[model samples]
Target: MEFDAVLIEPRRAAMIAAGLWLDKTADDYFDACLAAHPDALALSAIHAATGARRDLSWAELDLLADRAALGLRALGVGRGDVVTCQLPNGWEFVASYLGCSRIGAVFNPVMPIFREHELGFMLKHGESKVFLVPKTFRGFDHEAMAEGLKPGLPALRQIVVAGGAGANSFDALLSNPAFDSQRATITRDTRLGPDDVCQLIYTSGTTGEPKGVMHTANTMYANLAPFAERLHMGGEDVILMFSPMAHQTGFMYGLLLPLMLKARFVLMDSWDKALAARIIEGDGVTWTMASTPFLIDLSGAVEDLGTDPASLRIFLCAGTVIPGPVVERAQRVLGARVISAWGMTENGAVTTVLPEDPAQRAAETDGVPLPGIELQIRDREGRPVSGPGIEGGLFVRGCSNFGGYLKRPQWNNVDADGWFDTGDIARMDAAGYIRICGRSKDIIIRGAENIPVVEVEAALFKHPAVQSVAIVGYPDDRLGERACAFVVPKPGQTLSFEAMQAHLKAHNFATQYWPERLELREALPATASGKVQKFALRQLLRDEMGL
Candidate 1:
């Protein structure tokens, strides 16, 4: 796909001026901090299982990253190498990612839940030279998974495990005297341009194999500036990060943004609402970001424990839709605004509600496009759509837009004119505010009328009994496709399709939009990032409906 056709000329020019220049690479971001604040606390990693905490200063983090880079280089890792990382959220993951960037290697973050099926495909397709994983996390043996995949993945040259056996433990490499000496020789080189690939983020393949989205160092930086500006983050702010650093939201908003602003970040190995609240109340965390579910969990915990939400100033939601009620409760209970942002792995954070915006506006819309971002709604024929209240496929172009996918350079998703197709259906108001309706693939068509699944799902979520819900299209001989809902009721609550239909009907939803069939389950299948696995739910429906 070529992107030139959709590129908004003014937005492209602004992005060029604001985003980091190609001459300044990823390593330069870290180096600036080490030079300015050598003794300030840079990172604090808390082990969720063990209740252990490790702190690293600006100088210490730089040293550790350099040593890790040197150790990988000694094992023949160099420029353009793809390094697959499967460790949980912790200091090891942060250091290793920076180390790879320092040596011009592409960082590939894989979710820990991915086993042989997903892991094998990424390893082979990415042509990974080195893999950094934990020995064991939450009873899953990562070492065994790597060994199981070794036979099929011949390009894997080294397996560096963080905690388990049969591989080089990360601690030993950092402590090795030989590697320590090599760190002094490592220097930041400008040869690695901003356009060069810095990370290969694999999209959660709901359709088939995951595609490797190649993002550059400048793209990463471009994604962070608007977030920092909107939240009013500065060097004095302390951030608490519980999201995985390998994912785009975590890598950009949680980790890289803090580094860019020279702010202190507290990292947790896993998500625990109680622990996260304590970090906010006890550690003086001023800013944080996570999915909507996490915010719900945190709010519930706060209500149960009666904890005061005084320290937290900004609570941002990404990767998923933000429920209106959740946003209202967060503002009332936590005294922090719940801002929802939209983006994909291909582009970092693109659109977000500003912190100062009215709560009702933030809840109703996805907010305006961030500075340097050009957003457009286009018809199927690729003509730009004008006016308000009309939905079309969203096209985006800016400095933050990625060059292309990794390895499969020919598989471009951008148009020839430089506009990247977002695959999401959206509408632009006369004021230029963008509101996402749903994914084009996710839209349910009934008798030639498009039913916004997101709108239906959002309405269903407002029910007190509904814990989680997913709306998917089920094939129909008459209508082409009809809406089917899979619902997980809250514990001790009983719900049925009839009850949900009545509730939605009261809200003015068209009767035809009501789900024809509903499946009630104990839990909904979800990706590591907490998105509903609709494809899995579709298969479940097929078995039940006998389609």
Candidate 2:
């Protein structure tokens, strides 16, 4: 189907020029909102432990961000400087991000759980001049970790602690009386444009060292516009943000989208299914985004609490595939549409289920491309794949697509025609419904037949006893490489290889698809974002099986 040749027509020069003039830059999105609705509630951060809510009006948020930006300027931070932040989902994170954006500095938000090994790499790669971190969160001593790694990170010039003693407090930095004066003097000349780099988001590093993805303001803004339009979000909508703002989904959909639409944002420090449900029911949260695991946890808790789950209108699942039954259950029980999205850190949010899609269609596919986005499935030789149900590598081109990795120019995956290779395998139906097969690198070669691990994992998830499952290729002398299943059984359940095999057999999965070996664990190792750490599981299998 030569999808690119047919589907991706070059934009008219006049329309391109019009878009360039009308597009909102990161600073413009914030500044215009503050000017238009100064008293509107822009942010609400609730501390789950104490149930204390911190609300910020648009004026208040602007003042704080401006002050923080002035403070950063005083510290020699300027345009193009990278400021890395490691804080929980809170008002401080928002302030730091906006403060950086206000002055054209690139914001680099690292996950709070990242230790020195991961932190150092991001710091060096982004050439971050300053770091903002929480001192302690749930017993993780970030201060100690930062202090331990400070000597090795030569590019890191300053450290500001959001909380804790013996460090420069965030409040102190913004307390300067001259901050307001500096903000008053701030001009549009210092504002970041749509094309200017706004952030450097690092990949999850499932296969190798994490790459720092560079995104411009236009890339992120375009990613949110379609979602905002499809979801019908407006100033009255209240978005509850539980995901880390470091990742693309949280930054684009949860944060930037709200700001652009002039909606209220509720930020949660951590994810507690019960607390999340309460926020939705009590505060009238309209939208939220989380992984499938989080949705399962919240649905179970809502059932246990005997509370109706109709408060939230939009529930989005990203970062992984959504099982069919999970979507069905969510729709039946919660009255909220389960929107399965397909995107990566490089391209904020690309495809999402449209509201008009049939329930069965939504369950089977990842929906069509967002407006102004183009998708193509190509073979290994870079030729387009034709016909329905044919799986191949997915390539995408759109305004939302990021330019390239920061510093590491060699990792550019885009072709000469500007289409970025997504490293994911997917198939498109005649109706344009896309189904992700698996990651190109994650495909398991069993003898000569290619086994899509995602298909097997999805089939296993249907088992009542299986809470989570990861399929990895284990080295085997006899079969070259064999599929091994790492299963996390539901609480109070025990699953053996024989039992799992029987379950798969009953589910009508191919006999060869049954895992050759099974490893039972109380809990699956997961990233902070709830993605299964398949590489870690593979290592554990290698050690246990003595491969």
**Predicted structure 1: lDDT:** 0.76
- The RMSD of every model to the true structure, in order and in angstroms, is 10.8, 11.2
lDDT of 2: 0.76
User: For each candidate, what TM-score against the reference?
Assistant: 0.79, 0.79
Q: Model 1, which residues run further than 4 Å from truth?
A: 1-23, 165-167, 174-178, 205-207, 442-547
**Residue range 1-547, candidate 1, lDDT tens digits:** 1212122233445556654333456577777888999998899999887778999999888878887888888778888888899988887888888888878787889877666656788888888988888898888788877877888888898888887443387876633456776665677671255667777877642333467877766676776776578778898888888877777777877778888888899999888888788778877899888767678788888888888779888887765556677788888889988887777777877888887788876667777787777898988887888678789999998767876765565555676667888888999888777788767656665533445576678789999999989989877643546788888999999788789888887765647668988888898899999998888887888888898
Per-residue lDDT over 278-370 for candidate 2, one digit per residue giving the tens place of the 0 to 100 score: 888888898898777777777788888877667688788765556677778778777888887777777767788887777666567887888
lDDT of 2 at 111: 74
Alpha-carbon shift of residue 212 in model 2 (angstroms): 1.0
